[model samples]
Target: MKKAKITAYVDAALFDEIDALAARRRVPKTQIIEAALASFLSPDSAEQSEAAIVRRLDRLTRSLERLERDQEITTEALALFVRFWLTTTPPLPDDTYLAAKAKGKERYGGFVETLARRLGKGTTLMKELPLDLPGSTDPR
Candidate 1:
């Protein structure tokens, strides 16, 4: 049933608080007042309870954190899997490392260009890591 609007005078402090809440939410003051009345009169107040909303937000935050952690773990697992495949996986005598190298090049051809961009360098299609390491000197 549509109800007519009735004006009731509230205390100055309470009216100011309602105005502040309206400004904070960027909504008209009338809508906020109507929402408060509806919430109070609605049968399933528990569904719109502030406590339930807080719980849902907290749960979502935990879920996001878990996903970030799982992604890191998955990244580590992929790295370890790659290392194991390159080092320990036995290959056919007929199959040479050149074929594997070619496959790798085809798969991750843009890896170097992406790395350079991520390191704050301008994107270059062809890139070579210029690193001088000690103890193992093999210049190829």
Candidate 2:
């Protein structure tokens, strides 16, 4: 290899990064600078860069689809639970209504605390159940 020494001026921040990369990779700063310049100047890099971008976008699209599906599942579950609750809950008589309301409030506070603890612990019922279970129509 006929290597000739050349001097070039680089910004201090860029120089620091080059030095850091060289140190981390256990390579000379010249090699890092050469690799960077080669990547910058190569015609093939454009196509390669575009391919990399397309792959990333594909991954992001899949992630977004999964998010949408999850949201749909969550919305459906909440709606069904609310509907069932509304239909099943009987109206309380006026005499015991205040006591019932107090007890309901206490139970609700406990429910909220439990929910917060479960969320903080990252426990989710969705993850425990199989995908097929959610879509099943049969009661059995």
Candidate 3:
């Protein structure tokens, strides 16, 4: 492989950490940088990009926390709306009936059937997920 040198500025603490990592791993900074770049560029090199991964994970954690807070606020608003609507509006068709008859029942039914089929596999996804209580031991 060809080698080239490039200079760039970085935060002191972060550069120190990077240098420490290189020293501990007994690898050069260039090797670490190259491997990182390769992982970022490669389709199947996830294990090699620890720094990028930590950065991405930190970003995702922050975004997810914001989203979770937003979700809680949205859920509170929705619950309040539901309470107000239940008291004020004429509630004939409830959500369950409305959902069943929304012409989307077929889509939901298909999803249910797909789950049943996957559960039939036994040793696949269902093995890793929580099982229904008492299990499906009935022969009926």
State which candidate has the highest TM-score.
2
Over 4 Å off, model 1: 1-48, 95-140
- Per-residue lDDT of model 2, residues 25-94, tens digit only: 9999999888888899998989998999999999999989877877888999899999999999998999
| Backbone N/Cα/C clashes per model | 0, 0, 0
Off by over 4 Å in 2: 1-38, 131-140
Worst 10 residues of 2 by lDDT: 131-140
**CA lDDT scores, all candidates in order:** 0.76, 0.87, 0.74
Put down candidate 1 lDDT per residue, 13-78, tens digits, no spaces.
999999999999999998999999998888788765877899999999998986786677568868
72: Cα error in model 1, Å? 1.7
On a 0 to 1 TM-score scale, where does candidate 2 land against the true structure?
A: 0.65
Q: How does residue 78 of candidate 3 score in lDDT? A: 82
Score every model by TM-score: 0.32, 0.65, 0.32
Order of the predicted models by TM-score, top scorer first: 2, 1, 3
Highest-scoring model, lDDT:
2
Comparing candidate 2 with candidate 3, which one achieves the higher lDDT?
2
